[model samples]
Target: MQLKNILFTSLLVSALTYSAKAQFVGDALTFSQENNGGTARFKGLGNAKTALGGDISSITGNPAGLGFFRQSDISVTANYLNANNKGTYFGTNTTKNKGRVGIENAGVVFYFPTNEGYHGWQNFNVGISYENTNTFTNNVRYEGVNPNNTIVQRYSDLMENPQNGAWGDKLFKTVLVEESLDPKNGYFPVVGEAVNKNQVSDILTTGYNSRTALAFGANYNNKLYIGGNIGFTAFRYDTSQQFSEGGWTKNRAEILAKNPNSTIADPTHDDYKYVEANYELLDDYSQRTEGSGIDFKIGAIYKPTTDWNIGATITSPTWLTVDDYTSSYIRVDYYDKETDAKPFITKEVLTDPTEDSYRLITPWKFSVGLSKFFSRGLLSADVEYVDYSTNKLRTIGGSNRSREKAWDQDMKDSYKAVVNVRVGGEILLTNTVSARAGFNYFGNPYKNADNKQYSGSLGLGFKLSQNVYMDLAVVHLVNDYKVSPYAIDENHWKSQSPVADIKHQRTNAVLTLGAKF
Candidate 1:
């Protein structure tokens, strides 16, 4: 039965090697999503700026809101972020934290009142702004014991497959897996069964997605506002992962006891001399991705009454040209009890990094909002829709038809459309002071996973003096997901694979300083 399964997996691995360069669906989703980030006021209001205008953030949200500017305005925003992750693997929990401080946003808008009367065109506004739209800074750690299987089984399977070529030769040289005496039986793992082996993994990631936009807006009779913007986005992402497994011994007596009828029980058997103890393996992988893209947005705001505003906006897909580089290293250690007391060690390193360049098209976004004005403050809400399945990847400057089709199929199978919601309200406590609170819900985009995120915020605004003002906001967000360290064919293994549950939390504090002239 074992031999039959080995042959089956060999064929499968052989077929997969042809499309090794295909991009993961998760990568597509990562590039398609953005955070609600801008000025402190915008963050304080849950980023529901589709309808409520007059802020520099409008250059990215609803350009039409730029028309609300009655004077030249300029502002700068800074932010501090703290992120924590708790990962649970096989019932064992581990935690890690990270922090960073940086400039979040900066922009300026100039307002020009048209010479035409109020009955016709009221005003025109132009603005330029830069914003950090998404942050990928995080750290995660998970450790546990697997009693069912070891990663060696995966390497052993690949070693037996001729289609994978020499990819697993290092495992053989390191004696992590040995070829069967009977060639028909294929390769066998030297580490034996899972049996109380400890496993640990640490992952770190850092990056940011930023955008700069030039926008224009117009006001009609002081009742309607419309605007548009062309934006350029820059992206960078880097991640490193280290995984280690150890704390087990290979005993010939124990192996024979577990399978008394096996060939190893016979002293004359060629495999009987395979006695080892205290086995360990360390694997490291790192990858870096850099890219840039361009997109366009248009929006409008309508006032049905003095206290009501209705707004909507549509964003085009961002077309990105991405480049990726990756490298890997592995080390193995073990004591050859029968040969010497000292441990035997072997290492494998890929000195040259593999590079791939491609094109990615993100999903389009549609949003609608409503704002109700009170005597002193206002309440606003926005709903946004995005179809993640619309994301696509293609080969750059060449054609890889099969790979492109496979990537397209994977996107459709892995993602779905989702709706995001934001609600916020602000009230004036005094003529010069105001308070704000908001909530945001981002829906899950995966077709087979629960990855919803929730956020809440609080803010304070101070009118220091006429043209000079300051705003402060704090937002807390939570997200949870599951990750698998490696994949194994369930049918080929007796034990089920392990999965890690990760809970991520982040807090952001932002301060905006600005003046209106």
Candidate 2:
């Protein structure tokens, strides 16, 4: 390869707006956080456990609830996760579904049975747990033709306004195109019309958010429960994408009809009689993010009667530092205008990898719950509110302070507060078996849109022997959003780019085995 072409390959890779991120611009807040991760019973009960205690998983939310346990127990949950993401670009629609396995929750709780009659302190409990809270494994494919514009303009604009703020125009000339100055457009460069072409993209996303926690709590007079948890959280996220645009733009059938004597005889751009050349773009980009953090939680439950209980909890924002890495490859079918044909393939892999470190402060949340027990059944409900807008991003260096502040301000402007609600009920089916049902509502984080998620859950529990049991639960989630195949960032904002609509759905099934001593 020529030296200039090699430089072009490297510069163009850096010039594109693509980044290696665990969190994309649209799903960052939602993807970085975890959902409630616990036992099958906890999930089966809609995770409305603030006031309903007695399960080992409850320690994750409010350690005080663990006070309800009178026996020491251990549990492990296995899960099956399936996600289907659909997208529509222009008028074509495509869907991709992916399936995988995960361990959602596993933990143990120890209860010190107390006979202390003095101060009504019934018992003391301590627990430690590890749970997988959120997942990012998914796939989406969208394909269509964009008739209004070409990525050539995007390349030209990048050359005009370089990212480093110097010699961008000079560097642009080396790798991308031979630019001819135009009065109105500044630099005019076109391999061809890039119309009547094909556009396609396939992306795979994968990751997980998990946490390990230690909790302690005590029960007072069998009427009150108080507990707290010290937690450490970590996550890994990655996205790999393959996108292509353009092919043969014009056909010969329509050309010969216009000029009967004109000798354009075939559909391929190889015909020398054709006035314009043809080109294609095939590119791949992939990025990964890994992070670890810490946080704290405190909660309490008050039971005035044996059958009724009320509870509330406060969760502190997590302080996290994240590391990101990214790399890319590009291939172009260069069109020779003089010959009116594609001469050769220009392919280059940007082997240079980029890395960045940043700090993040997640949102603080508050929750309240109410539970009622009956002779044959029980009902529980919880309400939780989080301010998504409170999420902030900061670069590590003093010189990057302004960049971090700008990003933080942008997050505040783009996001809003959301309230999530969970409700569940249990119906006794037999002496040793019970049936459970629940519902949950997660408010949309985007303030300008009405996108929300609703989930329904069903579960069953059985007691196989005196100290052993099993629980099975299933939950379904659905939501809708939009994405784009490519952005016209250099010339026009993404809002001006073609919009692709998407609807995503997932199902999680979990089974928990437990033994009590």
Candidate 3:
């Protein structure tokens, strides 16, 4: 084989190994962040904006909203959130109680007039801004006996009783030797044994994402609006596992039959027992899954009268190409299963790890919002829909798991169009201060899955100057879901692991500081 071919093969193998260890689904790359008062207004109406203005964060929801801006604007925001996650496997508890924290968005925009002085067109506006769509961190614990009890016990029993025709007994014969025997045995004899018991494990994951977008738009005779944005996204993720994995026979039984410091009279002191070994595998997978993509948005606001306005927008999906890297390490040790006693031992460590890369296609989204003006205030609403079923994971190299995940029934299931409804209005309490409130409802994305969510919000905005204003919003989110595994144990012929149900509640808060010129 050529040297280059061998190197390429090794690299592919490493990539596949890394991909196998990072297997997981639904790390949703979509935004879960809501503008402080977005949910409240969203609930009252929905994102049906005939006139888009005020909040810059709303640009992603309705770029036409930018057409409402009379001048250039910039805004920075921060948010905090708490989540509860749970999982159940075949009526058995698998994982539960997960939480996380993260940052949402910060960016600026410059709105340009036609540059030719808005002659033929009513108004020409172009701008730039940044936003965050997804933030996550979760930890789960699964215990209550390793599900493969039958197979494991068989391996253990064979080791304990060498005469038993089991795989462990066969393995014991292959490695045992005469030179390893103790003086008491007439002939040098090496012994081996196996044991089986419960195996408990813990899994953890941490992730975050933020994006920078350059946006531009225009308004024609205050009646029609159109715009587009090119966004660059940054993504980070890490996953790890801790498990008890060393009880297979051959090795454990030998430790029991050996009375290294004792004579035949003290044989009773040396006994055979199952060895419980625990090891922690740490995988630090950190990389930038970045790609630049363009999204086009066109909207129109038709005003039949001065007080009422109707609007709508169609947003193209942002197609992105992602690249990622990962690394891992493992350590192991043994203890007496029954007595909880640690035998004199040293830890085994594996530091070098394999690395790999892969790609993912997140789905496209669609939304629309509308608003109406009254004597003292104005009311607005918006609606959004997304097709998550089209999302997919692509394997770039040597892994079979990716192939398996591709053909897996769970991955094949189609997700429903998730819906978001929102309603909001502003009341002028005074010349410079305005009050706002809104509500929003988001339908679950899973097709036959459970986990529905809703939110409510309120806020206050004060204009410091003609081109500057500060707004503070308080939002509350009520989220609930059902988490169940597709299958419980592989050996169950007729008993497939039924999806068990689990529910969770989450809450978050957001604040935005902005300026318009």
Candidate 4:
């Protein structure tokens, strides 16, 4: 019954939004997710994960592999990344690139070998690690026209139009009367289309995400290992946008007069007209949320022969609580010298509202891996599976219809099969020294019309000494895609014609250093 409920809940949660913009939710950070050279070298391989020793950072990949660690160790790694973004408006082209440095992982592990153990219990191991799982930083600026007033204001109007219905009509009646005007409305009827002649442009946005997990592992009889992670995650996001519109002076004055005691009003009077003019939508929203969750993994290692080993693990879902805060301001501009109203600054109300509690469930994972030690070298590989359908978006009281819809659409449009294939081996350069190389392929999470992206990785590791060793590895990632946002039609009030094609290329690199004690 519990399993059935889990599946049912997963399906229900996956029924949410799939919009391109909506999928840009919560937190996204790459430095947090990709820290080690080996992990990045092989697109995060797990089956052959046991070959890596020291530290519990690999616990997320496979817990049973912990049995390979025979020494107490500490390791830390950092990552540097470069991101390039490209977009087009109509036929015009634009591009952007940025660089960043981040701490990847730092942790320690302790091993206790059982000298006299019964029931096949070989040893016990405990560890604490901080592994960053995601990093998100991207800037996209495409200028065509400012659709905020035309689209958002129009939607608001539709909600108020009496002819449309009671709900929308009653809500926006005042806004419509104040917006629709002759002569200088700026929105002129050209070829039966209300062309937004007002030059509307400029948008800026930024995002941050971090997750710190406290994890522990135990190996029994060197055959079975179990682990669990208690993770604390924080998400930060901010967006700012500005644009221009003409003849908004009157509407501004009316709003202030109605709300004399409002925070966005003048000190002396509720004079909304003072700010009524061609103004900019100066908006900035930020949310800092924290959540705690638990993820457990159980695994079994079978060694049928001295040189061969096979392992499997099952992972539980992570449950999180997210608290978010948002605020915005609308400022108008009157630059036309011919107008009677002089240029003045108006501060619209400030809104720092907190959302109800929200919940996030990462996908459940199942994996298997194999390793072999031969006369010349060692070889390993891993396979993993996760179900995206079992995720959900919810507030404290319950799930949000809008957010849920967005998540569902994202899942439906996304590719489900995420296959990670990695193969690496060590060649003994000397009795005490070895050279290692690995290759990994992580299938793209998003499917395309042409099916382009599936990131591939390569890395090298070197052994320094018996009790001490250091590894330096570099990884490169490439992701290319074509995505489109929701389209607007001619019937809509000043809507942008459809954007024909959108293309994006992302290249990422990481350098990781590790030391085993």
User: Best candidate per lDDT, number?
Assistant: 1
**lDDT (Cα, 0-100) at 503 in candidate 1:** 89
The window of 10 residues in a row where model 4 has the poorest summed lDDT is 4-13
Residue-wise C-alpha lDDT for candidate 1, range 32-145, written one tens digit per residue: 899877999989998989999989899999999999999989999999999999989878999999999998999999999999975888899999999999999989888998
List the RMSD of every prediction in angstroms: 4.8, 7.3, 10.7, 9.6
* TM-score of structure candidate 2: 0.85
Using Cα atoms with residue i matched to residue i, what is each candidate's TM-score against the true structure?
A: 0.90, 0.85, 0.65, 0.66
- Write one digit per residue (lDDT tens) for candidate 2, span 1-517: 1111110111134324432221333445854456787899978888888887888887787788888898998999999999987878778889999989989888899989678875688899999999898988989778887665555555555555545334344434223333443334444333333355577778888999999999988899889899999889999988787777764433444334333333334445344333344566777777787888999999999988999999999999888888877776666664545355545545353445678787778889899999999998899999999998888776775457766666767677667898899999998899899899889998877654446578889999999899999999999888776665544543332224556667788899999999998
Per-residue alpha-carbon lDDT of candidate 3 for residues 384-414, written as tens digits (9 for 90 to 100): 7666665655555436675647523434463
Output the TM-score of candidate 4. Answer: 0.66
Model 4 misplaced regions, further than 4 Å: 1-55, 116-119, 144-234, 237-288, 329-354, 372-379, 397-453, 483-517
Q: Tell me the number of clashing residue pairs for each predicted model.
A: 0, 2, 38, 40
Model 1 lDDT, residue 430, Cα: 99
Q: What is the TM-score of candidate 1?
A: 0.90
Worst 10 residues of 3 by lDDT: 3-12
Candidate 2 root-mean-square deviation in Å: 7.3
Global lDDT of each model?
Answer: 0.81, 0.73, 0.47, 0.46
What tens digits encode model 4's per-residue C-alpha lDDT throughout 254-373?
A: 444444333323545543333433433332333334455555666666666768877676767666665544433334333424355665544342323434456666667677778887
Clashes of 1: 0
The predicted structure with the larger lDDT, 1 or 4, is 1
